[model samples]
Target: MNKALPVILICLLLFQCDSGKDGLPANSQLLRNTDISLSPDSFSPWVPVTNDGFSLGISQETFLSGNRSLFIENQDSLNVNAALWRQTYDGPMPSEGRRLTLRAHLKGENIELKSTGSNIYISVRMFPVEDSEGTTINRFLSSQNRFRIFGTFDWEPLAVSIPSFPKDVEFITVYLVMGPRTTGKVFFDDITLTVE
Candidate 1:
């Protein structure tokens, strides 16, 4: 009976350790409330823009090798625009109590003069998909588009704080929008999200 008691106690201890409720375990590091980092070689899975005339491409001359690559497109016509690519996953995010910080490193070159305006902004959005329209209720959590120049390759890092959202958030989307009324080229790379 004494030996059996010792074995049972050990089993109970192991069970508690294996249950990850205390905090994140070694293998669970990636399962946090932050967006994955984007390197030159690694990109967050992006949903292609299906809007009329918008397109996406890969740029090599402008990215940091092995861990950085640029997503580029031409918003030359009034109807065409550029957007952040999106991807869907079944993984879990951090619980709703924590605040999320989004970060990105980007550079723009050959931006035409006519593209200057508040419409040319970079934004991050979170949306919940519903059964009715096949479209999600989009919440524009944050954005940045105020620039002083065009045609210069400016390397910039942007960070935005996202408040705790409702539990219904089904998808998070990031975008680089050229005002639907303007025309030019846009480039982006290196995005990160952290929980605080």
Candidate 2:
């Protein structure tokens, strides 16, 4: 084998790992503002889900890139099962890939889960259209415990890939979840989605 083969392979690996540094790939043509970088006048595409004691918004205190990151926090005053920031896909359905992947960079402090089922993770809800009317949706997430943060931690990357999306896919809902009455502060940046 050529001496340069190893170096080229390493470069390919690094590029995949740092794909979020500049922005989503050219093929990621489905959603807008996957990263919390844009200052959307109305924040229309990304909806803030304020439920129970959890609240979400953009934060500048810490970010993986750009000037701000999406932030979520659970208030101690209330006990809730879950809260999340959600974005429903509005673009054309992806018809090429058999699987979809979602990823984001996150940092957190004191992420305490009240129940065994509680988890802090990202979820992708898929709506595949079998008829012109609509279709039932299914949700997918990264392995729960592997990426769950219960204590303070530095910036980390988490990813999930789910297979078997039909060619006639309708839409997808992406979620940044703090669940089962999870308490703590988490900031997310460079959230991205891709079909593969």
Candidate 3:
């Protein structure tokens, strides 16, 4: 059936488009580079970059699900304040009273925390998308949640839930950060954020 061939192709294309390029289900909406094994450049848009201190790389020596995992090390040689990698979502915003949860598999090596502020944590910022481009924005209509991760440990489950938002926020940014006075290495895999 030559006529059925086109229908089959169309169905396949639609199915492929429903899921993410890295095989994430349609319900999972927080991460784009869930599995590092998909591609060397699978971590598109999200760069393993930092402002002042830290080193970022991918490693196969340790991982939770895939053949590769993201590894970050604080260079003790530098006066490090924060060493972090972040993923920002400029897409649709969750509605008010929506419950959001962040989860990840993490392992730390000789990790130390800061004495003053949050030493190591997942920082979540929800803000309004700018209506006008290139405008300096400086306000959070909703609360910010910092899921702190501390100490040295094996691959363990780390998760945090946001109760609900009082306002309609449009943009979300998640960061895997080691705050001031934090050092050593941290490995992360299977990081996810879900809205319910």
Candidate closest to the true structure, highest lDDT: 2
Off by over 4 Å in 3: 1-28, 75-80, 129-150
Candidates ranked by TM-score, best first?
Answer: 2, 3, 1
For model 2, the stretches where C-alpha displacement exceeds 4 angstroms are 1-26, 40-42, 128-146
- Arrange candidates by lDDT, highest first: which order? 2, 3, 1
lDDT of 1 by residue, 95-116 (tens): 5545655566666656554533
lDDT by residue (tens digit), candidate 3, 1-196: 9999999999999888763332223354776776566686565545665656677878888888878888788756345466667777766555545667767778898876645453656656666534235332332221113445667789987776666633545667777666666677888888777766
How much lDDT does candidate 1 score?
0.51
Local distance difference test, per candidate? 0.51, 0.71, 0.65
Give the per-residue lDDT of model 2 (tens digit) for 1-196: 6999999999999998775443323355455776666764544477877776677878867888877788889857247557778888857555533467788888988877777777788878766534344533334445466665677888898888766554444577888878766788888888877766
Error of 2 at 33 (Å): 1.2
The TM-score of predicted model 3 comes to 0.69
- The TM-score between candidate 1 and the true structure equals 0.59
